[model samples]
Target: MNNAVTLKGRTEGFQIILHASASFEEVVDQLKELTVQLKKDTQKGHELIFFVDTGNRLLSADEKKQISDIIEDEHFKISSYESDVISIEDAQKRAREARPKLEVRTVRSGQILEADGDLLLIGQVHPGGTVRATGSIFVIGELKGIAHAGFEGNENAIVLANFKYNAQVRIGGNVHVIENRDENLVQSEDIQFVYVNDLHIIEVGSLHYLKTIRPEIGKHSGGLF
Candidate 1:
């Protein structure tokens, strides 16, 4: 009998269990092989589930990068099958309520701000300034400090900024740091915020709702003419 990868779908999330006999290297090899197969047969659709044993520590950065690449590739869409899953309607409602509205300017040292909708920063957030929100964060200037989105446990929050030289970023508690600055994220006035699969924070293109939410910015109260 040929050993096959097993995937279990549950209400909460999905679980993938690799056969006990499969080694880490073998699993990786199989993933590559599957990638090829998926490419060959576009209609079949590529599906995979990765089960990580508690005893095994996932420490290989390269392997992780490869796996991430595979999952993020345009050709594949991975879904989680788990026991306790939230319905689509419930998820959307939660996302809207949990989405915060953040507005700030030059978050100084030792300042902590939290929002339940979206975050809009008019100026820079200095180092040591901490801001967290449940929805999205928009910084008009640079983000050279610590910021977190989805702090209330919602992962759909995004962080957008005019510049991306942040010291640290946490999306749903998943932290990312700027080890080095590049042109794509340096001195660029154009920045945006979005969530990855409603799971992680990402840079996107404009948060249009800000105008509607903050009507005072462009509102013209008419005087007796």
Candidate 2:
């Protein structure tokens, strides 16, 4: 069998890395073998979280569901399963009213950071850097990279940036594409947040306005972390 899959234990949970270039059949075969190994190694009467880390490949919704079905059985009662596309800091952070804050000097090009819950970042997101989360994402500095929030289909997720017009911003299944910049267009200095409206359109507004318009937007139930 091809070594298309591997498992590693993370501080938050277990991560299963699937080779991006492997065929779907090869991945499935590896997963079957992995399940057997995991079942035998797992201690009796204990629960754990498992995450699927598809490095550069994006799994379709159907593919994700198939993986879930494979791991469902009597021996492995997975407390939670999630895509490692977004990073979850820790379950411990969920108990607090405040979210976990990541203070980075700079997220350089080709770097990626994922979170399972609300995340506060105090730094710059350079071009090509990526930030993804299952919940809201707050950037206190310039955002010049990609920011994806509500990764697990949470429509209420928001993306906040100190400056306007970052590289790209996507929330859930919606991509906020910017086009046709007027010759006189000017960047704003206001702190802004992006959220999906009820109409499914991505909207951008001042942070204060968003909070006032949707106070509930700030409220979020921590997903499996």
Best by lDDT: 2
1-225, model 1: which lDDT tens digit per residue?
A: 344344456554334444445666666666666656646765555444433321232325585565556544554544432223445675665565443354646788899877655666677778899878775566777787877877876665566664446467777767767533564544434564444443344434354753443333323233211
Per-residue lDDT of candidate 2, residues 77-181 (tens digit):
444444544433333545432455466668889998887666788888898899888888889887888889888888888888864554678899999853326
Backbone steric clashes in candidate 1, count: 25
Candidate 1 displacement at residue 141 in angstroms = 1.7
Model 1 CA lDDT for position 168: 73
Displacement of residue 168 (Cα, Å) in model 1 is 1.6
Task: Give the worst 10-residue stretch by lDDT in candidate 1.
Answer: 216-225
TM-score versus the correct structure, for each prediction: 0.41, 0.52
Model 2 stretches with alpha carbons more than 4 Å out? 1-98, 178-181, 217-225
What TM-score does model 1 achieve against the real structure? 0.41
Say which candidate scores most in TM-score. 2
